[model samples]
Target: MLQIEKKKCFVELGKFLNQFSLEENSKNETVLHNDLFFDSFVDLIHLSQSHNGWFTPEQVYHSVQSWAKALQEENLNQWLSNYDFSKVQPKTVGLILAGNIPLVGFHDFLSVLISGHKVLVKTSSNDQHLIKFLAQYLIAVNSEIENFITFTDGKLENFDAVIATGSNNTARYFEFYFKDKPSIIRKNRNSVAVLTGEERREDLVQLGEDIFRYFGLGCRNVSKLFVPKDYDFQPFFQAIYEYKDVIFYEKYSNNYDYNKAVFLMSNFKLLDNEFLTLKEDTSYASPISSVFYEFYENIEDLRKQLENDAEQIQCVVSKNAIPKSIPFGKTQQPELWDYADNVDTLEFLLQI
Candidate 1:
């Protein structure tokens, strides 16, 4: 129902996002409403780090660039192609967003609006500014979208259905609170990488980006590694040395110092570089500045284990060693169709 005009509006917004990069904020004359929004967006990106220490300008720009590529006309068409939206009755769907990373809830926002549904958003306090600013730009591009978007501060009351993302404890609370409504409640999940000893150093180096991006705050960041028994970790430690500068960030350094001291106090053996620590653990969720690794006995056994534990994982980074796995360093670059928790968000929106 919103395929024609609204699609173009989003594409224009994409063009706007593309203009700003870490290297430079270049203005393209063709982009709509640049006079009103461009300078302000740049200011916001710089000011974001002050608002939330984890939201560095580089991370915010990376998120912006990713969304820009996803909002291309061809990408949008491809994403919406399979769904038949002929009968989508517009309803005000409420969203409870997470704030682990910058713009983490934008996908849910886009899904609801693009599927011809009104969205009532309750943004996490940690991430309150960027989404609202983006919404303003969308309204500027296409005035019709104004009625379709609303950001609420109080309890979400006037919505037909809900989608909420949070930690596992909060997920239980959401399930109880939204019991009377149709809802999708997401819980904590982590990503892991499967490594073979035969891999080149370049591969491990790329995996460092997967580990260090967004200070490993995003769910897509690889928090654990599955390695063959007796796998020499020298290559990994050597390769990830390129990311050693990550320790320069005060927040990351604080986490590293705190987590490393705690591990030392617990008498756990750690393979530590100056910046990152590798611990042998069975848990999927590792703290920031650290990655937990487990030695797998066999490929088949590892694959089966991953399948059994798929619900707790957001991504499996591998070189085709596992089915449905993404490549190293690519967990953060998900395509539009790659839904969080493997749930079809657009499908849910259309049905709602």
Candidate 2:
């Protein structure tokens, strides 16, 4: 229905969103997204709970509004208005979302929506509710969006492009099926922090957020740390231990227990934080039960290793001096300029 010109629609959505204050203590009695077009998003938080983690409805509401604000930016609007949608006409995209973190697939979802393409979402069952809620909201904004979106239980086929997120094992399957087409197939890559031995205790405390958010399941969550061997691990450990209350969650406890038992059975050395178990490993993807860390004696060596391992890394975080291009906080709070998997989503959409 909305073949072109959505200026009024976005304006109305922004006005509707203003009705709910997204501050920490807003009562949850009102419609979250507010517009009749997006009322279906009201149950998203309930859906996140049904999955694995305990995401409050408030968190969902805030994240959605955050996305709305970005989309409503003047420069973003200018870009969308000038783009020739016909360049990517009728693109059929198959997307495999990662559930390691809350709303990780949102960027891809927006890439399709703003590019005017049809999306076939294969949501991670672990975080399926978030996407459904977001889709419902978009559809409410413009009822025509409903026809542009669809859920598929079958194998992806006849798609012009595909985007998949999975572990190394599943990536093989994705590559086998979608390699022939233009696609972005993400394999396991962990975010890491390179401490230059001069990091303040306070920064390490914030680094805890990088490690603990989403229970360390997201790709952006740092599963590995590269610290100087001479650097004392005590302050770093102490900073993270302050948040020992993270273990209060049953989900985190379950992982802690399961990983502890397995580590003992396999004879692995582990450092425990009551909530997180840290170990030394070369790998980046850590289990919900344990995080992996490695020590390096020389900053030069660490830099060299990271340079060699660049292709295998998603991000590098450090308060210490480093290249400006590397992002911090494990999470890719990327700008519109940050192309996913280093590929320009807009360009890819246009090509399709």
Candidate 3:
């Protein structure tokens, strides 16, 4: 398929996805293949949590909604305009996706096909269904797109380049295994927020969205916070009260209970609001149901610290305390150009 054809296919898929939301599922008769896909897609959204406990309907729909907005013609054109595809030579690219969040690897899939490369995907068992369902929808939109995509249960092979997301330990194995091929190997990276203590309740409430979305499993989720030395927890806790309902989910509730117990037994200090716990720690990667925080003496010094640790950080959320910080609660809602690991996937694919 031509590049324009591929873009059009995704745009159509986006429209199909736009109909689904946690609030309701409304079918648009104008969307192609709705007669074949609309109802089944809604069933899939409802079934996602049963398949993967963390893939709650709200989270899945949020991801779906994000992509629906992302694949608009204008967004696609704006994103692709930066790269020249005239010199591109098509190649088969293998993708080993991480299923941390719902459709977490879809962006990589989209990047491969949108860049005019054949994709060999090994879907993480945790996220096996959703991406495949979308791929099927894309094929239904244009049968030619079928030639550009493949999913395998065995192993990835015969691909010129690779893009893999995994933990730091697995990254070591991936680096050794794909040493001969051009690759983008992603390791564990966490996002953090720099709190200035002047944030409005609304700003912090939105920040709660960043923290609680996807049950705090995504790399873009704000798992850590940087606060001033004398920062008080009263305002922060009160601001995040809106998300207290998150504790009602069994999986999340269980995690809160377990992690809190571990922290208590270890004699670590904690600020608790029943649903979430705030721990003072220097680590960027926090466990589920909790966010790690550390005090900073100076904003300038903290900016220097974060920049030096950029590899371990995915995004820095702040109003303006740190440089290039993502606004209060926008960490999870990344633009098309916001590449994971800050590594340009399209650039890697096009080079292959």
Candidate 4:
């Protein structure tokens, strides 16, 4: 299939996704293959949580809407405009997906096919259904796509290159295993926020979205905070109170109760807001239902520190407090070009 054909299929898939949302899921008869796919996709979205406890209907709908916005013709064109794929030869690219958040590996899947390569995907056990279902929709829209996509139940084979996402330990295993293949192997990384004393209440509230979205499971979620020395926590707490209902989710509440007890038993001082706990720590990866914070004495020194530790950080949320920092609540809505781990996935695929 031509590159334009691939783009058209994805655009149709996006339109199919655009019909469903948390508040409503009315079917639109105008979408292609609606009679076959529209109601089934809704059922899958509702059943997503049963497949994986974290993939609630709200989270799944959010993921779907984000993609619906991204896969428009203009967005795809703008993203692909800078890259040349005319000389590309088709090859099988193996994708090892991460299920930390809904559709976490869709970008890699999209990249391979859009670049005129066949994809052999090993879906993360935690996220087996959603992508496969979408692949069926894509094939329905354009039968040619069936030649380009495949999902593996066992070990990956007959692939020229690979893209894998996993923990720091699994990354090492991927490096040794795919040493000869052109690859992008991702590892554990966390996002952080830099807060001066000048943030507005609205900024901090949006910052709560960065913290609690996906229950803080995604690499892009802000798990740590860099606050100025003696910065008051009262306002931050007040602003984030809007997300207190997150605790009503049974799994999150269990984490909150358990982690809080563990901290209290260890005699560590905690700043608690009933639903979430704040602790003084120097780590980037914080536990769920909790955020780790560190006090910095100087902005310049902290900036240099983050620069040196860039490999360990996914994003920095701030109000121009740091260079190239993402806005407060926008971490989860990454653009197509916002390559994970700063690795250019398309460039890697084109080379292979």
Candidate 5:
């Protein structure tokens, strides 16, 4: 299929996704294949939590909306405009997806297909259904696309290149296993926020979205904070109070209770706000229901430290406190070009 055909298929997929939201889902008859897909997708969203306890309706809807916005013509054109597709040759690209958040690996799947390549996908068992459902929708939109997508339950084979996301341990295994194939093997990474004590209440509230979204499972979630020495925690707590209801979820509440007890038993000092805990730690990766914070005396020195540990970080959120840092709450709303681990996926696919 031509690149334009693939693009049109995804554009239609985006329109289908735009119909669903956390507040309500309204069907749009004009969308291609809506009669078959719209109602089924709604049922799938409702059933997502049963498949994976962390896939709440609200979280899944947020991811759907994010993708809907991303697949618009303007966004798609602008992202693809940067690349030259003339030299592209079709190859079967194997994708080993990560199920940390809803549809987390959709970008890779989209990248390979949109670049005029066949995709052999190994959907994480935790996220087996959603992407497969979308693949069916895409094929329905354009039958030509059917030949381009495949999913496997067993070991991946017959693919010329590969993209895999996993923890640090699995990444080591992937590096050795896929040693002969051209690949992008992603490991663990976490996001951090740098606070300068001048943030408005709204900014801090947005930061809460970065921390609490996906229940802090996504790599883009702000798991650490770098604040000035003697930074006041009261206002930050107040801003994040809006998300206090997250504690009502049974799973999150269980994590909160268990982690809090573990900390208390260890005699560790914690800043608690009834729902979330803030601890003083130098680590970037924090546990669910908590964020680790550290004191930084100078911005330059902290920048140097973050640069030194670049591979461990995914994104840095701040109000221009660090170079190229993302704004508060926008970590989860990454653009098409915001490749994970700063690796250019399109470039990799094109070259392969």
Candidate 6:
């Protein structure tokens, strides 16, 4: 009965969001315009800025709507059909939210809520507002959410299952404490891009948005690039230089200065402009100083390199052919179906 109710509720929520997406003050429009609505949202985030990271309100709204659509009834049903929930029922689920990116915990939150389990959330101080706002909104939508969710500022205990997201060090702590329980302990990760010689200048510019938006703070942001050995770096750099205004922000400036100092100390080479620092790393998620670019001589070698680094990457963006399972972000926006930490959250929900 609970499962049936959740499915109906989600379907209704999804429909409402579809309508919400059409409003004049829709989330995307506000982001694209960088207008008054965006300013208000930025203010809300500023409240949480004492820590390292805070989300723009546009990021919060888009993520919520996306989760509603991705975890819709039919998808949930398909995932649940193969599992037995009788054993996982009424579990107390604990979730640790990551503040490195906005709405990083939404998928886990949806999983616990739709599973009909009680949720205990430990929110990152940097991102407490959106969850608090949504908690209120959920109650408005179906008041009964109050019965299933609770926010905590301290330690939680006796939870049957845990889904925690944090740095690699923090994940170790969670593993030690919850190893005996059913858990998904997520470690730090970032995404990457594999560029073939065929990428057009327009696509490269949009790809810069993937790298520069949010000041390169999110897990979805591409920190590393894989390019064909013969591909020239100047054109790629030129395409992204148009967004140089993005680097003018004080926060980004600080990172750039700090990284630039470190680069000078280390005697590393880089080509910099107003917005980005371009360096080379064979890894994912570059620092504020620059993104890492590596050149591969052949497609087969590139594929081999990507396969080796698959465990470290959350997603891979490419203009060339990509696997069906890998998702693509349209411009700087992510659809609801993109799961963070590479977890299939809706599938986890149905089993509980």
- In candidate 5, which residue pairs get closer than 3 Å at backbone N, Cα or C atoms, i.e. clash? none
Residue 188 displacement in candidate 1 (angstroms)? 0.3
Clashes of each: 0, 2, 0, 0, 0, 5
The RMSD (Cα, Å) of candidate 2 is 3.6
Runs of candidate 3 with Cα error greater than 4 angstroms are: none
lDDT of 5 by residue, 112-209 (tens): 99999999999998999999999999999999899999999999999999999999999999999999999999999999999999999999999999
- lDDT for 75 (candidate 3): 97
lDDT value, residue 202 of candidate 4: 97
- Give the per-residue lDDT digits (tens) of candidate 2, residues 263-318: 87999998876677878888877887577888887777778888898777777888
lDDT of 6 by residue, 1-352 (tens): 3756655555555543443321233444411223323444444545544434434433444554565566566766765675555655577888888876656677678668766788899998777776665555556556676788889999878677788888889889999998898788888777777787677788888888778766677777788887777678777887887778766566777888898879778988876774667677665767864788887777776677677876677777886544532333442355445566557665665454
Clashing pairs in 2: 37-140, 220-330
Of models 5 and 6, which has the larger lDDT?
Answer: 5
**What residue runs in model 2 are displaced by over 4 Å at the alpha carbon?**
1-42, 54-69, 75-86, 325-332
Quote each prediction's TM-score: 0.99, 0.84, 0.99, 0.99, 0.99, 0.82
**Candidate 4, 200-257: lDDT as tens digits:** 9999999999999899999999999999989999999999999999999998999999
Report lDDT per candidate: 0.94, 0.69, 0.93, 0.95, 0.96, 0.67
lDDT of 1 by residue, 1-352 (tens): 3658778888998999999889999999989999999999999999999889999999999999999999999999999999999998889999999998999999999999998888999999999999999999999988988989999999998999999999999999999999999899999999999998888888899899899999999999999999999999999999999999899999999999999999999999999998999999999999999999999989999999999999999999988889888988899999999999999999888777
Model 3 quality (TM-score): 0.99
Please give the RMSD to the true structure for each candidate, in Å.
0.8, 3.6, 0.7, 0.7, 0.7, 5.1
Q: Which residue ranges in model 1 land beyond 4 Å of their true spot? A: none
TM-score, structure 2 vs. true: 0.84
